[model samples]
Target: MKVLYKKILDLEIWHDYYLGQPNPPKPPPTGYDISDMLALVPTPECLRVLRNLRWLFRPQPRGASIFAHVEQASSGDFATLLPVNRPEQLTFWLIVRDRYFANFTNLPLTTNRHQIYYFSNLSLNQGHALFLTQPLPNYAANSEYHLGQLVHHDGKTLEALLYQASASKNPNANDWDILPNSQYVSELDRLPQQGLSRIYTIPKANPGDIWRLTLVNVHEQETFVLDVTTPITHTPGDAIACSLNFSGQIPGCYKLCLNNIQVDRFVLCDPIASKDAFALVEIVLNQSLVPSAFSLLQPQDGNTLIKPKTYVIRCKNRATRWRYRYEKPHGFSAASLPNFELIDAKTYATKRPLGLRLQPDSLLTDGKDQLLPAPAIALIKPETDTQAHVTTIFSDIHL
Candidate 1:
């Protein structure tokens, strides 16, 4: 529901079908925003379908982002069910920013028992439908299948019985089972505690070839090489599976590297942490970083005078980046301190704002704010050399 409406037509379309009504009676001036899907009021049998959709598309998990999720999805060609919304059998698509030219140009989507639609790979883009709201194509021999998938084969309908790499045949006699011909059940299944946590497909992967996968924690600065020795099996297309199992590990921002080159980055969080947004921090620097120190040009330790609302700290280094922090009245924890960056390298002076809390019994001239000089620290990283460094300089300035 947190959709961004960029044009007038977007607002109009939302107004017309916001109450779960069908599409607009007729085409509006904007033609048709095929990208914006208007949900329908669920029938009595499919009421839970709407609820599941809301849960799947809810705001990103804490410490994660939509872009990060998309990057993982687009890393390679894949088809997977939305993890939490499996009972509904809704298929999710994760397309790349640039159009992906799939090996199979035309793909079939089974929307219902009687409906099947064919779409071109060109129709896929970052803005495509998040969930197909339908099942994927019929079962193919030796193809990968996720849990709770509905598939129609030959004359009877079948569903996937196992998790990843499940039984490759129909469940009537193999992995999939036929559902009773009745109203759709709304019963929810408990969340899976164990299974393959994540899956990635490697396009153009040579059959029987192995690739090295490393999970690098952005915060802890730790790298763990996963045992990915299992040979990938090539099917229909050149795409192969690179399933990632991060079970029993701390959840944080992780970078997926293949053969030493960073391929994708994503955030992993527990169910509780997924409720709130976590600041997405990227430790990987795209450019060269070299730490360099600079001498304080102004406001030396003993140099104290009068300044109204702010004070300036001058430095001689022309750093590519600069950040600073000041001590608080109570005390200062370096880890908890927030950084304030100076954007321009030419500006040698960093202006520190003074925040004053006045008390009824305290006179303006006698207040602590006017009596003490704050301890400050400055950090800089220059691009002089290939080696990385963090140069820190400390000083005291009167306000």
Candidate 2:
């Protein structure tokens, strides 16, 4: 049986992050010491769960982290959060970080489910912290999710954020299964002939326990016999891994399963999406983009795109605002318009998307780390509103 993570306690770890904000230079001390363990245990379930909790770790598809998977849990929020642990669902995660933890003292003595906490220091000059975790399913290790509110911009659509309850399942049996070694399932799914071969690290499940891959779109249809199957390795807790190779013929969404239980959803995106747009946009714009370049399809004046791609609208003369929308990908289902808010923006001397740019005479070098000369920037202003069509190219931005 997989151990589900729950019952966290009040914890404080010095941090340097915050919600919807940038990181502070010097972080403040969290009101706890190094020897504090948030009353946790070391177990197979805890180890896997810990992999999902990213503290002082890179944003997502989290790599090996400082949080050790030893059977014991840290005195902090090192435990990755599981979906079934919702408040009314027998497992709920309650986190009160930074100033909130320090200001509020009327917290429950023992939460019925679990808690992961981080309290801010008594000072305002120190860096605060943000809370993030992984989806307890098979996907890229970089896959991450946050449990807080995100600030947004205007002229975009808005959807009511609601929690739709899934059909109930026994916690002891039906839960998420994380496949550690998977990089991208879409790569294999993109082509019908280009077979996808990859490894999956199953933290639990017998090696012979009837593993199967079912095409989700072809649900209720006949099953294509497995073409190639190989057992790679197995660890304790009945954990095992396998190398699965299949004909890209079944190009669509799919679910890997144990017995009849679903594991995770994987999709094959259009292969053409792999083409680098920054280069194309740079060529079209004539000059090089500063820091980064963004390119996108046309959008309306008031509509907003839910996707993360930014728009560098170079209007005739500081146009007050710009708008964008998402078009359905070439072969995917038609997408409904979603609300978008400005996560970021930049201004530039928008110029004609033609003409060779004058090369720079000098490049700055970072003495310590970077040996490569810094990229030269071009700030040519736009000749007219004609430059509005040249900004925005981001896709496959998952939550």
Candidate 3:
């Protein structure tokens, strides 16, 4: 005789048989082992039918030890079972302890069916019949669900099985928008437009030194002259010149034309013998050219003291033509001298200073019988008790 038991979601199945009285446990039944029979009912339909079987009042009739097996479709394998039934109980708790059998599932056990079937192949194991219960739910997908089982034998003794499933794990998260912004405009737009004009130092002119003139356009745009001699020039590049013999010092003034349209007047100081003495000139233009109203002062002397041994004699303006004469010291007659380069006529209109070197062939002695060479002379007024007297000396000239 043999006994077999199986349980599903809502059903149960039990089989009872006789194995002739326990005659020295002849080799376990070869054709139909209870463990082999339990391996067949893992399908959903078999599990549902097994869950309905009644086993609450079945007594623990002792015979031979009963071996149990369970299989699951989701996990794809069969597992050994622990005897979890108490005295007089018809239900038993099945536990799978293998790690390989535990993790083999695509879906959780609660959602996937796990069929449990149990059986004994011999009547010798009749008193020790196996028990089966409902498939345990998979709480790994949602840990809140729990599964607990208790097996009762003959309605008195009990065995308990506990199962716990946890929730899926998580990682961490990140963020990125916490800083501020910065930026604005500048201040160079408020100034006036101005251009660079060349500086000119005047020259000292003796009786015959030539004068040259030049008009320079310092502005980017061309300016016109309206009336050359009336200070109303509207045309560009206009100029004029006059010749006067160097007699005793006289007040100097002149008028000119700029672009043949604008007239401008210039006043010059009396010619002096010292290098530092200078003349002033003013150029006035029409109302439209007021922004470039120009004025210049030029010296009539050509002496410049650069070093103790050197001196430079320069021409004043460019437009004026000139001749030169040299007289020997002792009452010798004056004669026109040659061998001088014609100065650039355009240089003087803009008031550029022109220079020439003076190197004496022999040292000349002064009135005091002291040897003096070609150099600059400085003029100064002496301080007296009540009035000042002027004094002149050659070493005091500034280049």
The ten-residue window of minimal lDDT in model 2 covers 277-286
lDDT of 1 by residue, 325-367 (tens): 2342433333222332232322111222111111112222211
Q: Candidates' TM-scores?
A: 0.22, 0.22, 0.11
Q: Enumerate clash totals for all models, in the order shown.
A: 3, 31, 74
Ranking by lDDT: 1, 2, 3
Task: Give the residue spans of candidate 1 off by over 4 A.
Answer: 1-196, 219-222, 229-237, 278-399
Give the per-residue lDDT of model 3 (tens digit) for 90-171: 1122222222221121111221121111221110111121121111221132342111111222222111111223323321
lDDT top scorer: 1
Query: Please, what is the whole-model Cα lDDT of each candidate in the order they appear?
Result: 0.29, 0.23, 0.20
Query: What are the root-mean-square deviations of the candidates from the true structure over C-alphas?
Result: 30.0, 26.8, 63.4
Instruction: Tell me which residue pairs clash in candidate 1.
Output: 63-278, 171-176, 291-389
Largest TM-score belongs to which candidate?
1
Q: In model 3, where do residues sit more than 4 Å from their true spots?
A: 1-358, 366-370, 377-399
Residue-wise C-alpha lDDT for candidate 2, range 260-359, written one tens digit per residue: 5565544322233311110000001101211122211112232211111211100011111112222432221112112123332221111111111122
Who is ahead in TM-score, 2 or 3? 2
Cα error of candidate 1 at position 13, Å: 38
